[model samples]
Target: MTTILIKQVSWQQHQPELQALRQQVFVVEQKVPAELEWQADDEDAYHWLAYGPQQQVLGCARLLKTGTLGRMAIAKTARGQNIGLRLLQAAMDFAQQQLGLAEVHLSAQTHALGFYQKAGFVSEGAEYHEAGIPHIHMRKKLSPQPQLGISNGKFFVSQHKNTVLTMAQQCRRQLRILDYNLNPAVFDNQALVDAVSALARRHRNSSIKLLLIDSQAVIKRGHGLLKLQRKLSSSIAIKQLSDDTGVSDNLVLADDCGVIVQSLVNPETIWADFNNKPVAQSKIDHFEILWGQANANNDFRLLDL
Candidate 1:
């Protein structure tokens, strides 16, 4: 077996080799037009190349600062050797570790959806033509590294009401949210609404479980999350806590890896967000226990009100 090595190289360091490999795979082999294969964004992206034991470039991919992964191509001879997966993993690592990005997105050719899907990416949107080939947008959220202490993890503090949405974008498998009133000001924003919808679309097998003290506000506001729950009813679920449950903290847990906890419902209240696995898991376990006893909100008509 030939040992394959993957490296992050600058455009100045491996432009010729990267361009040659992309041309061979995207242009010649896949029949993509040369004009569409090359783009100005390539100038600023971080490129990863896979090299075989003999130092031959087997594949290459690039990561843009905006969390877009593009120009991924594996050599014809290197197909079925797991080089593409290695390259993608490298790009994702750089994006999360170096760029501090919460998620990575890509426009995958429809035929390659399964390949990426196996590596944890979720496909979204309708299939569309790109460079005369069918393509779909895909995304994968980066899981935060486990931290033993609060001082060692990435921390976020915000009075901005969209903090929940920011936390949602970092979720990969599960999103457990506990809030009072299922606040419309927080869940009804267009951006957060779209993020939830995208999350449901991408992670069809995952779940977003919501526990709220009251649903009247969400129902009265015609919130997007409610609409999304109706459309993707299986992937998302809602429950209402009894008035005496004594749940005062607003919490958001992402995949048992990251968490955001707000002590009160006031927008001005200070909140803490971090990527501590143990802490997040403890909260998730507590939430599940409470959820088990919570009452399901099956009234769809309230969402329409």
Candidate 2:
């Protein structure tokens, strides 16, 4: 088996090497115009070069700042050696772990769709021609993401119920949730209640604050989450937003990292980011403002755990 090592190199340092591989695959063999093949983005992209055991460049690729992968080329001499796969994997690993990218996008040649698909990229839209070649746009999510575009009218509750459970399981020292009535399907379920219960007991100083607009729904419908707050009130406290505050969004913050935001009563837009600290912190700050004026739910005394 041929051994190949991939390295992240600068365009200036390895211009000749990078140019050689891309030129062989794109301009010479594939006949992509020389003017179109060499791009200004080449100097700015995250470039990767694969080397053989003999120290020859085997393949090369570049990842743009906007998370687009392009200029991927494997020398004809190195075809079928898995160098392309290795080069692509290294680029994606850097984008996710090192660069903190949420996803990566690429344009795949029509004949190479299967190659990118095997690497977890999904094709989207109709086939289009690029650079006089049949090509299609593809995308692959690299980091943890919330499938937040749930718009099903009748099955909406079940769609994102798992999202709540996921964010809860990822919580560390703090979890803040602001909801109107603790949407029964999403938060009142036993699985989520148990997860939050475990979170409260796992970290001693962990603060789990739930801000609700009303507790009447849980009182009438008998929610397991209501039972949880009653038993773990010391670690997990529930509060009610002041009626006059007029907040109308469902927001959940998990340890200042994960966030879920949705419009309440008129929930047309729902979004979540599991690895965004800045966005989560911003929402938590807003939650704190509401929590400061919020009062503890005295109604929990109505239920005995």
Q: How does model 1 score by TM-score?
A: 0.49
Q: Worst lDDT window (10 residues) for model 2?
A: 149-158
Model 2 clash pairs?
none
Candidate 2's residue-wise lDDT over 1-305, tens digit each?
45566678999899999998788788888889999988898888889888887998888989998999988898878889777777787788667645779899999998999999998999999999877999999999974434322211211221356667877876778988888888885788778888898889997898799888877776777778778877888898888876836586898888867777877644534566666667777888889998899887667677663
lDDT of 2 at 199: 89
* Model 1 poorest ten-residue lDDT run: 145-154
lDDT for residue 134 in candidate 2, whole number 0-100: 99
lDDT of 1 by residue, 26-96 (tens): 89988999999888888898998888879999999999999999898998899998878878877876777
Off by over 4 Å in 2: 1-158, 244-246
Q: For every model shown, what is its TM-score relative to the native structure?
A: 0.49, 0.50
